[model samples]
Target: MVKPNRPQFTDVEGLAAMVGHGDAFGVGGHHFARLPVALLRAITRSGVKDLHYVSWAGGLPLELLLEVDAVAEIDLCFSSLDIFGLPPKFRAAAESGAIPVRDWTALAMIQALRAAQQNLSSMPFQLPQGSDMLARMPNAIAGPDPLAGTDTGFIPPLRLDTFVVHAQRADASGNVQIIGPRALDFAMAGAARKVLVTVEEIVPVGALRQDGRQSILTRNQVSAIALAPGGAYPASCLPFYVTDYQALSEAFAAKDTVLSDKLRLPSGGLSERLQEAAKVSAETVLAMPAPAQGDKKASVDEIIAARIAAELDNESFASAGAVSPLANVAYRLAKATHAPDMIIATMSCGHLDIAPSPMVLSLIESLDCETAAAHAGGDDTYSTYYQAGAVTHEIVGAAQVDRRGRVNTIALRKPSGGLLRLPGQGGMADVANMHRDYLLYIPRHSVQSLVDGVEIASSARGLLTPAERDPMGYRTGKALVFTDLCVFRLDQTSRELIVIETMPGVTHQQIRDATGFAVTFDAGCRELPMPSGDVLAALRNRVDPLGLRRLEFVSAKERGALIAEILAADRAMLERLIAAQKSPAAS
Candidate 1:
């Protein structure tokens, strides 16, 4: 019943053969969703080396390649394990200079790919002037735009040799259907010389035409198609399975063993091993100790969230990106309380008109997908909103903050020539350049973080005064910082962050001691307003009933304890099963 002349229908091996050594590859998926894992496994089995990867946010597949020494270079906006924390293998490789890295912001990456798709030589963008990211980027040139007649940065086109993507379904004729928010997949595919798609299912021809909106690719654009159910294992495929958080936790806990023994398995055995590992992980999570009840005390994360929520104004459009659970909580709490009409846009949830259910550990899974007023068309939506100055507020965090409120979320080059590469700038650069107001949320305030100056300015208004900002297309947004101990506001005249208010228990000396540089206090500096009974009630009872905020403070020892308990339970279960089988009277 299958038609042979319908397009090239192939298997993983065939897909791998299409990829050659030293080819520049573009991968689809953001964080943990819809990754082309099966094809990546095949490529690993084929022992391809010296690959160059272009990804929006490099996740597990990219980390695996780094571990195997197969990747020569990486072009990415950000790279991490999401909620599970850092990707150890990738971090080690990047820090050791094992692989070359070219970092880009999420917006810049999309713009560059878009330029390639349109056959343009380059794309102009507005970013924070004097940012170290601009200086490091080889292709990014800084100058006044001839067309716009303003200061701007231009990124050259990035065209890949091959692009691999995963979809929910596809017809035999190679028409691909993608559900949920399509990240940079469409543009990446269009900009690539060849496109390969692995889908969960392959339907009959004309099956996808029923919903034309979901069909993002046609036969002309697709080079080949393969059926790869659960191809994005470990990562969520949406409407199919959520991310395997427990498995990732276990993997991170035992990174050496997992990466060496399990992830290095041959293609024929990798999927099976991953499935077995996932089963164990599921059991471990089900056996985790229940959180203590009857404790109504607010956690450090909750306090930070509540304070940030109070800063939101009604009827304003606010956005939060990845690794910002506290910011997302604050946005939801604001909607539930003071800002009932606030429009919140999260990178995972898109545009949410209504308040999402109580916070969960994972933003991608718990946020309301059905009720999202609109999907954030990935980086396109972000860039469009920013350029149009539609985003009023943005909540972001960074690895380091200088006296001038500048942020650095990139590498920390040591005097000994060692490197400590943090997750890249993501969309913070775009947010700094466009939004009317933005807040920096620092969970841990210390001398190291509140430094005199950053080695590299990733996002900030360095020397750009209000006059300069206007000419450069930068907004005159109030730059405020919220930390665990105090609140700091940037002085309009000095551009230096000065203490505006201290927390309930914090002292002036504490603030001074925590900051690396000499501290300055405003004349009106006083204690921050404590969270009212009403705000606490809404946050605990409605906004975060599950008490998931505790995860942010969960220590490594606690995680080890949980893992030990899981192993004990597994052993006991196995022993009981063996005893029952032995006692059943051998036949």
Candidate 2:
């Protein structure tokens, strides 16, 4: 049933030789985790041209492929560098209008892949109302549903020619094993004609069968296997390493050049070293002494986190998407303090119903799975949580939000003429209508961000009244917006954002001056309650030990130095996790 004799035993260079011009290519991993870097390096070096790259959640891999003028077209759900900021090459390319890009929503992307794997011509999906995502998404057929006479959209199958992934271990028989959080890789493999895999370890067929991790791509599905230990470096490969943020930041700084030699480490004696180091890091985290409480000045990050935590109930389903460290902190802070039973999903990886872990960088990759009650990919997550309306709250950041609650995450038309591109609308288009409480946050809110009208409505649910939503089966809840200045709640009847309370230092007059629209607040208005001792302690000492939330508040110029400091501390812990034989179970 497999294709006729795609090379079964080859190195990365040999595999790279197989990728032809204009082939639809897929790269594995979610965000900065578990990507096939060695293979990407090989592809970049090989000088293949005019390839159509498909990355459902594109990150470093997408950027790397764009280095040598290889990718002619990119079909992606989003392109970002997560906490580091925008993907430089991807952003520059989009801003310059050099290469063509097709921005797809998360759910639509998966549905397209599903159609491909299932051998269907096209897949029909429910079009989200109250947004213009469909207008921006090219190649999608949107109109009245001929069958039901309701709104609908259809996308052609994402037929991929080749796909590559990195995994913990694989056998000569081509059994690929992923230790944890196999995000979108399975769907990619299923949809592609040729599946190439690189692994951290190549084990005997018998050992591969007996390994505790799940074997996702069977021998029949895999076309080739390459042995490359620590192949997923710079990106975390679970028990092997956490994201090499220092290396990644350095690579980003280097501009368009490929820094493979400096980034990839020799795998010999690496496992033993990382295993021992991991044990030490685990002990350090577990044995960390509590900091003494005092009049330590509270940061804006802590204030926002505490305020968001206060919104949580004892038992609610909350989700923190990729690149949202503030939401990550708030959800964990809420669980560690008041809402003991809060169920949280860590990232787009779908680490569903995870136990609250410390807000460490490694926690998103290592401890997330160790502590998670269950794990699934993007498809299962949407089906079970997002589409079912089980996710009560999801806190997302916006590039531009309007008085009517519409968001612009796609791009902003510049006064000078061209587009000022943002990270493409990831899942916001679809998930905007999914969560029970459609919560949005803007870390640095000003007249520019809180606009009268957004340039592109990538996602919105501004009208959330029971009357408007009950008939559509959408969740009826408040559309709350949080910012550095104050909190604004959307008035469904009026369909406009209204001030609820100002921050402690910010006055109503300051808010009015900063806002682009009309407001109904003055100097004598209620301010958000100051975070108490317990809340501050939890934020400072207990939850966010690495200060990940501060990444959101800092300016682009300031982020490098701040990231270096945080990543250095994170590296020490990850080095230890990588050394341990059996990672200490997440608690």
Candidate 3:
């Protein structure tokens, strides 16, 4: 698949030349998958400065860009390193107010892009009726809704000077082939004035015709194509390699804030790095062993996951945002066991209606995204599900949740009467009200987390009654709270969370002691119904072989060890899968 210089092929310097200083650049990919990292590196290496960096899911790519002070401002929904915690650069910049920022909700950010895509000055999004997003930003405008009578919010278009994205492969003719999740690349490509693509490999002109899904972006849409193998090196690029987690984790734990030399690739270094990534990805791992067979004593994490999975029936539709392995596992387990027809969308938009695959963070985008039926952007997902009120279930986490079902993911109150900044609400604010079922899970069920009241309600479920929701074309939903100790459901009449069921060993007294507000149990309360033997088997063997569900439950002190174990298990699994794929019978 060696590519000759046809019209689209360009060098790294040439690709970087297309971008200018102080440009509103739209970046593609969700979380840590298929990011045009090599292209970003090239831009920074070329000493481009004062960029208005834009991203739907701003994480590692944002960090890399910010490392060299390339970004003077940011427009993104959320930024975090997932399990490793908040991105250091983003946190520092945000805390110090060193850079201008436009923190957006998932809906608002996508709506802006959709506006640009449709050639509109502004696009109408669902009004955040119960969310404090408008109050926080003070920039969103209200649009007249003559049709439904419900207030509609309009987001100004986020026109991009340049858009950068990575794909699995592209031909010399600039026909890009993305094997797994397109995420927001197609939308970004439509919204940008110029599209710059970095491909893992360059095939012949007709080679991409083998699959229609690969040919979505035409040569006309692309401004230039660059030859960069292992472009999304640290991130997962399906059909080639998964995330190099060891390198990423090392970066996470590294004291140095600057980008690692491994990531800051020279022109010739990319090929060598790609080869090393391939060799390391499939190598046998021995640090962690599989859980023992057939004895079905469930851990607290397994019990919670099982209980959550049981809530979903065959008709259920579930969605979970990024960095949520527990919810991701539950959705997959439910679909694999009883709820085979249940639809699941995870990693925000990267994996939609995904098939049950091994729950390894390293290969999440690879395995899950590849098996998914469809991938969408923020706009596509919100329009179809959130705005339409079509999603039946969404498992959202909270930093602080009150007895009134209000959640705060924005900031925490410090004892000194200041705010301890937390990760901003990444559409949890919208989904809390919009989704048909508000499923809140808190791994830690302490008094601090299960608060009496939230200082600021970043997200709260508002449409509990038909009178309020029906008139607005919204879904009437109830909040169900899942914790390590007990399960609570919002008493619709009271609009207050009451303990409905206790975990296997948890007692009423313990629940009362842990809760911040006065505790009341439901009249029909019973113990949490444990999963069936078949369900447990599906979880252990098929869905979560690496025990990734425990990630949410582990402590900050214990997280390092748990991540190491999971990574080792992930490498081991990849080794076997790759070997199986290469087997004679598999071929």
Candidate 4:
């Protein structure tokens, strides 16, 4: 019987030490586990074999743990070799009859944790418990209410043993304080065994009470307090400081290194003051004003110039009759995989041309969006619907990803001390939840995109900072993150993102230049294809084209190329774009 007052370890190792040798902790089985890698490492170091991970872990850790002959059973939600990597342990876990696969949600897990925290046998949940996942899950029963079957037929009554949390600040008595987004930490705290709290700064008791706002985590609910400065490092959100995308990108890029190289970052090295300062720096940069450099007159001139250049390029192309490299790539992939209905995108500010070609859009438009949307069900609200349900495949993009198949799409800092903060909860979180085979798409190298740490608060679910996700159940989806030059897939067995393929023209040096993280090559890697003409045509014609005139930062060559491509699809469309470019209303 699990109870809320039980003594749990605040140290990661202690948390791991609590699980039975063969006991399996059921993480959110549909997505990635929210625990930080360091904390997870302690659990793995505990040498338990029976692990019930969510769908999003990607199997990298499972594979590594298997190598030591420690793991014996496993469970999965959906299988995507890219996010989860290639690992034999996945098969072993499946064969062991220990696999308890099911469809679950962050809400259900939170309810379970809440129940554990409340020291109750079970807590009432109101989510769609009638879904297939809870059909036969132990302890989950149909509600007695007559209206229960009207929407979802059932309710989940989850049971858990422990809930671990890390916070920005805490007193020695375990008064935790958080500085970022809160999904359901309070509910999780209410559902787990003696909650373990880790804080960046352990303040005196009086400090918390002095400010009425310090009720982030009360001391009474916490069992032990651990002073682990920088403990959150790459996994926790330190308000004001964005994540270290550079460091994380390097780890993702350098796939040949030991998995631990990607997981272990020294957390105890940084002083409390420095950590706090770094956090502030991140916030300061994010708070900075967006540039107001766009001038209407200049924008019109640039657009006209670009349009003229494109005409020349098109004439040249007419003679050469050259095929677009990107178009050809898209065609082959569509042909080889059969026609997929939708395409997934990220940070997509209403523009498909950022990376997708016209031909790709055409192919997508040909499919049935209505049908695709229906099949996608609750997960279809994202812009990228291709990867949602059974629509063939879709493309996904991520900012920072670790070997554990974890992705960071939230706050990350730039080298110049700037931050790219989302004004709202962008579609990344929704995309992660809906997409089935997420194809990560990004440039080969990111100057400040990948980092050793993440600063921004998570806008969506998957593996949120320790403070945000407590009690170990919620998870997010991460399939393959494709960059300009290479593709990183999760090893199915270990659930680690490993280099599985490289782009046709990508070189190691070029990849390094294009990426913000380290990259490795797969000896047996295959070449990824680009967009086809049909797809490109659709992308060009169907998607609205916007011209950024007087955007001084715009590259002339890129502008010319884009203009030429846009004109080739339809001269009339180009005229509209030019008109828009000339309009002051564009401002």
Candidate 5:
């Protein structure tokens, strides 16, 4: 795996000198700026280049973000907000008809590379078989050999010459560690002809091996490692350090943020922000604990049983009767079981007040990011773990469900019209495919949402038929349909939907009445526990005051009763504990 010794560049300027003017550069994840912003700006400003990116290029990494400093410019497609880290200016530029907008999915790119690595003629992508996107990139979809008959026209394979990445740490020999989902980062390493890595620390070859199989990134594919301390500063994580959530949010919010801004960023602006953010003190940040180490994994059977219990007891939390029981269950489960090395949670984009804490901070305080990311899943760094494969479990909100355990987040039938639609299908398709453990977080028993079978044709884009079942050996590894009243999981053998647990207030009949299909109920379903009074207070006072806020909306009676009942129940539990503690006879 020894790389041929090649000339090294000392700085961004030196690196730019080697790449020369007008050369095309492929960045690993266009989610945001990864390279020095200064170099990106310089390259784009010269106006002597063609920049091609494999990411959705219209948002955060917009061309104007680079052009502001006269750095560099790129002309490419994939201009929708669907691209993970695109800046607003980039989207506007595409809308302005300045740059071409190409529609493509990350999966398509990954599969293309997979096809290339395997030396296939071309890969058959599932979606967009007759898509408008295919019409634009005829060459991309058209295989080199027309006789091959493999292209499905949804998305074509992407071939790149070089890929640049920023890592938290890398050995001198090039093994790297990405603390979270370093999306497409690995694929890029394997797909590209050359890989350039900039890292915070350069460890000796033996240092990375000390961790054994725990190493998230292997260095053999790396062509170069630049000891750029703070090199990925404000852009990449250094493990224990804080993720600049505000900076990323602002970058997403800014009109002109772009990949060039990230690549050739001037140190001066970020330095000041870093200093200000650092005023919070390193100790505060470091206090966050990593996921409590040494906890064992919860077996699939164990998880099914727990969900049953949680569902049975869900009423305590749903009714605002005392969320402590629910919180305690989560806390205890987290404490007792080994958390995944990575976890992903789908959160709504709005509602900043409850946004999840930074990953580093979560590691310090809670040791997991689910609750935190649930609040901030819409933030720029959302879904980073999806590409990284660090997340073993992901909880997402679903709009509908079927008897077969399939869930849908978008596109349902409307009372007025035959179809009601959101913007379009999105990451759910990928998340459903990727998550080893998938939990659908939704309120129980929505009359309209639970479907007996697949409804609309929106996802006909990549529909896998029933006959095609288990073709890939991917059964939804773990699924828990969480609702206000009950929780359900797919049976291992049948994949038939099964109710594992019910809320304290909800009866089996109630659940049956709620679901559209005949649900197989656990005859001995358990009830969820009541949260501790203290945890209930924290949740009521801090986590959620309204109790019903997490729900889309609740009636006045619903809110008042749910809140008062939950608080009173917790108070009752607390008083009993206090009385027991005070009784000397008991002692």
Candidate 6:
């Protein structure tokens, strides 16, 4: 029934063949949405070795390839499983020095792809000067800008040999259409030598033209198209499905079976295996108990959120990036309480004037607000707004913060040659540099996190003095550090982190013992004002009634116990089914 004249129509094998060994492959998707998982699975099954990968927000595809030893090198902005937690295999590979990785912020990565697409050799960017990223990346160098007459950092173009993306629909002529934010897919497709697309459906030739705006890539840009429905699998494909978070969480919790048993099918195709996995996921979720409820008192996450919200002034325009659920809540709470006119931006290309109701775990799913406006253009447009000083405030988190308020979300390299890679600086570096002023939020406080000096400075005030920072386009430097135990601000003279206030019942000794360096305080250090009953009510009853904040603090041991309980329940059900089948009723 299909036409053979369509050059776009191809099998997964053909898709895999297009990407040769040692070629740079640009993968499309953000976190979990619209990933070309089926194609990646095919490549893994084909035993294709020594491929290099470039991604914006790396997740399942990257982790799977690492598991099977398919990747030789990777270039990424951030690599994490998002709400599902860290990717075990990717961490193991990076920490063990089995693969080489080059890190960039989300904006930098997107700009690099854009530069390649426009056929430029490199692109100038405003990055945090004197950050450790400058040292880690050889291609990223400071040079005199011909236009500005001042030195600025530049990132070299990342040319890809092949680019792969999954979409909602595509025509036989290879016109690809995406429903939600395209993220980096368009730029990546343009930057690559070959473009392969997998779509949920193959429609008539003119079907995609009906909505010209949604059609991101033309026939000339795309080389091959395959019908790979549910290509993203556990990840969501907007307009078709929400992310199967329950399934993905279970798969991540049961790490031992994810690669060998659930993902890789022995005989059937990738599509079939994915369907079976989905069924299993649904059943497992149904069998499990409901999430545990929290006590009547305010959770640590709510307290953190409220404190961050209290910092915002009226007319503030803020942006919160991925893995920042608490910050997202803070934005909403700010709008609802004090800053009624505050504008909040989400990574999913949405702008909300009104706070979202019953906050979801992921901001991408919080698209139902009455006054929300969608920015269909994606990250490029968002970055432009950030660069233009439209974003007045930003809430960013870090893996490490030094005495000078420098932040590091990259890796901690050990003398033993193993690297402990935290999720790389997503857009934190860019936000910290571009925004007028920003607050740094750290949920957990410890000696390792509040360090004497960060092992790697992913985002920082840098060595520039306050006088120099103004001319360099930095409006304010490291305004505040909000942590569980206390609030810190940088000292004006020494630029050292100084504790200004402590949470109720927290002692000076406790703060000192937790910090890696000697603690300093203001002359009038005071106890933080406790949240009023009304504020606590707003956070509990309105903001997050489901108590999703518990997910952030759930220990590994607790997760293991939950996983064990699920497995035990599943085994009991299977045994009961087997016993029923053996009974002699009909026979």
For 339-454, candidate 5 gives per-residue lDDT tens digits of 22222232212111112232221121222221333322121222344433333443444557776656543345567655433322234444454444556645436656566764
Model 4 regions lying over 4 Å from their true place:
1-16, 22-35, 54-100, 112-144, 147-152, 210-215, 266-587
- Candidate 6 C-alpha lDDT tens digits along 512-562: 999899999888988887676777776665565444554455565675554
- Quick one: best TM-score, which candidate? 2
> What TM-score does candidate 1 reach?
0.86
Candidate 2 clashing pairs?
274-578, 274-579, 274-580, 275-578, 275-579, 275-580, 276-579, 277-576, 278-576, 278-577
Clashes in model 1: which pairs? Answer: none
Give residue 528's lDDT in candidate 5 (0 to 100).
Answer: 58
Global lDDT of each model?
A: 0.70, 0.78, 0.76, 0.38, 0.42, 0.69
Taking the tens digit of each residue's C-alpha lDDT, what string does model 2 give over 1-587?
A: 24533338788898888888898999987787778988888888898999899978667887777767889988888888888798878888888889988888888888888888888888887676678877666567787778778767898888799998988887756777887777787778879988888888877767866756363667777888888777787777777766666667787777555665546665552444433332344334544443444568787878888999988987688988877899989998999889988898976736877766666675455667667777778877877788777888889888889998899888988878888888877888887877778889998988988999987898988337887666556678768889999989887768888888788889778888888788755244578899998788878777887789999888889998998888887766555444342444432
Query: TM-score: which is higher, 2 or 6?
Result: 2
Candidate 3 vs candidate 4: which has greater TM-score? 3
lDDT of 3 by residue, 186-213 (tens): 7777788878889878888888878744
Estimate the TM-score of every prediction.
0.86, 0.93, 0.90, 0.42, 0.50, 0.84
Write down the worst ten-residue block by lDDT for model 6: 277-286
Cα distance off (Å), candidate 3, residue 139: 2.8
What TM-score would candidate 2 get against the native?
0.93
C-alpha lDDT of candidate 6 relative to the true structure: 0.69
lDDT of 4 by residue, 32-68 (tens): 1112345545666666665444222334445445545
Q: What is the C-alpha RMSD of each candidate to the true structure, in Å?
A: 7.0, 3.1, 4.4, 19.3, 12.5, 7.4
Native-to-model Cα distance after best TM-score fit, residue 367 in candidate 1, in Å: 4.2
